[model samples]
Target chain A: MTVELASIEGQRPDGQEREQDLSKSPLSIRGLTVTYGEKPAVFSVDMTVQPGQMTAIIGPNGAGKSTMLKAALGIVPPVSGRVQVFGRPLEEQRARIAYVPQRASVDWDFPTRVIDVVLMGLYRELGLLSRIRGEHKARAQECLERVGMADFAERQIGQLSGGQQQRVFLARALAQGADLYLLDEPFAGVDAATEKAIISVLKSLRAAGKTVVVVHHDLATVAEYFDNVFLINTRRVAEGPVAEAFTEATLQAAYGGRLATTQVSQLAHKA
Target chain B: MSGEEFVPLSLTPLLIGVFAAVACALPGNFLLLRRQALIGDAISHVVLPGIVVAFLISGAISAGPMMLGAAGAAVVAVVLIEAIRRLGRIEPGAAMGVVFTTMFAGGVLLLEQTDTSTVHLDVEHALYGNLESLIWLDAIGWSSLLDAEALSNLPVELPRMALTLVGVCLFIAVFWRALKISTFDEGFARTMGIRTNALGLGLVITAAVAAVAAFDAVGSIIVIAMFICPPAAARMMTNRLEAQIGWSVGFAVIAAVVGYVLAGYGPLWLGQQDAVSAAGMIATISGLILALAAVFGPCRSRAGAPAGV
Candidate 1:
């Protein structure tokens, strides 16, 4: 696997108009496939995510948006494909990325402070058995402040609101110090204020030259929030600039048979 | 021996109690964190038949075979719990209740059918052992110069109870971080490159070892208490992982000493019925601690709040 990844890096085709550089492809997926038992959750797909860009993957329910993100991060293994990060294989480059799972995916009643959750972003860096140092705490506090959650740093995680929890998770991701961030359904169930905070954070991350890929459910917010969009339905339908890839036709392809064309058309108009 | 006779404080029970508390609390942290609080109860009960079957086969109380049997039985309980979820459409708690109780009942019936004289499988005794009666057996070996003079020659073959506890605790401490991550958010842990399956299996193994340890000290009935009460109490007191662990160890150790002392003195003071079983008393204390925490601990009203709003 290392050799294959090394070869791919060594054999980067010249003159391909590298968006960033061969050395800065934060995430790259080729012919990625994911299956749950015999059912294909995500079909063969290929894409490259450039650093310093806010990319949103938009699709209806069960369109494999989350699966693609997970598979790319090696959370869920791809049936057959290659996922490269920072010119290295996913395993070798784990510390270079952070993942924010869906807020609803965890038990809220777990007894942990907000700061502790954020400090988890440093786990890969600190490795197991290492204590959280003063510097780690300072960084965590900084991340919380960036998210307007500094005051709540000492709050029990279960005591926070949905938006607060989401910010805490984002803060953890920020504390990770990774070049790539993969977030799943981050905006789901969040208030408008929280949504704006998250978007601003994403923008700042992009401004800092970090790659951000989010599994977004709000179709209307896609064009406004993200610079690039990937429309998915078990497979990649289209991926490019938000304006070019998020048209009515692509929406039709991604949400076929599940959403009414009239409703999607209305959504497209809103977008 | 008269009630006034001094047995003197021995290191055996203390070491056993400390080791068991540490071992059980280590994995119990994960179980409590995962919200699978009743899993310990389920595993302990399920191990009953495994112990009986092992005894029937070996005709001796050997730690190795009994541990293997208990581990096997615990695995079966997990499988049954999953099966019930898949096939019976039952909630996990109900499935565990069904599996454990039935297995425990079957184990009792099987034990009754066997030789009553040679096999001393008294349910009450199993639930709470007479720690006072545990003879100060010979120490197993190698004492250093720093060791207390009296304890230097003490038997090292830690009572079956203490050895099991130390072994289980060591295992948990070694896998602390992995277990913590897995218990908190299995999906996220997996995404972060931690093997959730391996961590989960390790938790199960720890649970089995805890059960075996409890089998000799407090017995299977009260083992559930050791597995649960300390962690639950600790949960209410702190949010930091290290603090939680520290509180759990502190609570367990206190319960062990208090329970042991009560068992020794309460019988003479009351002068009638047998004093409450030390294990049961300790479990009761743990329960009381949990109750206090539930009532007085900070309320978790912010749970289920939306994120990134």
Candidate 2:
């Protein structure tokens, strides 16, 4: 089916547009509670991510950071919640949102080239039985070049290194041409150079007025990399401007006693 | 006698086998790529009861009733497997095992309840097809194409299989993009608004139709080998989907031809009087080709390719 391409921020002077503009947020989640069988993964949480900013969902292991992201995207059904993107339901605004799942979630050895993966980003727009035109191919190539992966566009995905593979995934996300991007662990295992490249790309996205939410774990660079932080430990611990919300107390609360040892290691590395 | 004397005798049966093999291989590629190869085997076995039940209800073997029964059985097989997997929280392979074994056993019991001996529908024929006996006993040579009598005498299985293969190829051609995207990455395809679940169901139903068509000529057991072997061997030869499909059809046709020739004439060359079972020989040839591809394929890692990959 052809995705009905419409403005993420509705253009008509209607009551709906007025309500959406009042929120002024790209994503709004209310009472998002997710449970797995007898245990609750995420307690009742309310979060609103502003437009045109880099928001980091930071938490320690088993803190439900990724689970929260999935719940917001409607990938995993929340026990009870509502997620609105651009004041519309997530199902209605999915075309305007790009989602990059964890690198481990996909089969890298699939018999497809890098260009094919990038082209998949456009499949929603192309619809069924339609040939991907030269313009689409050129756009895909442009996206690949943006991530410094144009040279590897024709290569099989499995042939790439770990860092290069992540770049290809980024290129695929870029090809979506979405105003909002949700990425999961973009720097989990990359080298410093790859990490720098990814951060620069994320910054460029913000400069272009695109909302980018990343699930991050490295506490050392959170202050430097993010404009806003949502520290979560099953429930929302602290959230706001990174300088104000990302305090030592918040980190200690989210990570428990582990934060002391992490601070010592951070200091030792600096020395 | 000249070698040309044997051409007309073997031509129709050989063509039928080739058509059935090629038809199975087309949808078989997707089944292999999707790692549902056992489902292909499952559909083939389950359709046996479908065909028998159709005969029982209709009190005769006809195309419409038989196809309806087979297609219904195929859908039931898929649904049951899914239900068991979801309810029992078991491995998909185990679920498939439970559903298909019960359906096949049900078919055997159904056969026992009735007299299938009067009709062409017997357990032995369904298991091992009587391919050698399907000779076009008409007046003459290859030049008899001008006579209506020769054409009329041609076996019914040949044309039916030919049409089935054509329909399968057309379906694949129409849905090539959807099939590729869904088989490679289903979750992403769904997020793209591709209706991936419907596409996946369409594929399984198409596979069932192709299996049922092939079953009439090649029998049920060998359909499994035809469904998995050539596609698997083709996967070893190429990493591109289009090239893989082409290689699969080529391999399937070659197996049909080589296997038929071996079964029909190899005994004569060995100083024996009668021919061997063509279905068994074709299945054996498919296995050999798969083994060969595993040993010396372009992709060296294809020896034990994981289903998830």
- Tens digits of lDDT, candidate 2, B145-258: 677977887878777888888998988998888888778776566556667777888888778878887787778756888999999999888767778899899999999989
> How would you encode candidate 2's per-residue C-alpha lDDT over A45-145 as one tens digit per residue?
88999889999998889889999988887666789988887767777777878877777777676667889888988877876678889999999999998
Which ranges of candidate 1 are over 4 A from the true structure? A1-25, A77-80, A257-263, A266-271, B1-18, B75-99, B130-132, B137-165, B271-273, B298-309
- lDDT string for model 1 (B168-228, tens) is 7677667666667667777767767788887787777777777776675556645787678
Runs with alpha carbons beyond 4 Å of true place in candidate 2: A1-23, A257-271, B1-9, B71-92, B133-155, B302-309
Cα lDDT computed for each candidate against the true fold: 0.75, 0.82
**Each prediction's TM-score versus the true structure:** 0.85, 0.86
The positional error of residue B142 in candidate 2, measured at the CA in angstroms, is: 5.5
lDDT for B303 in candidate 2 is 24
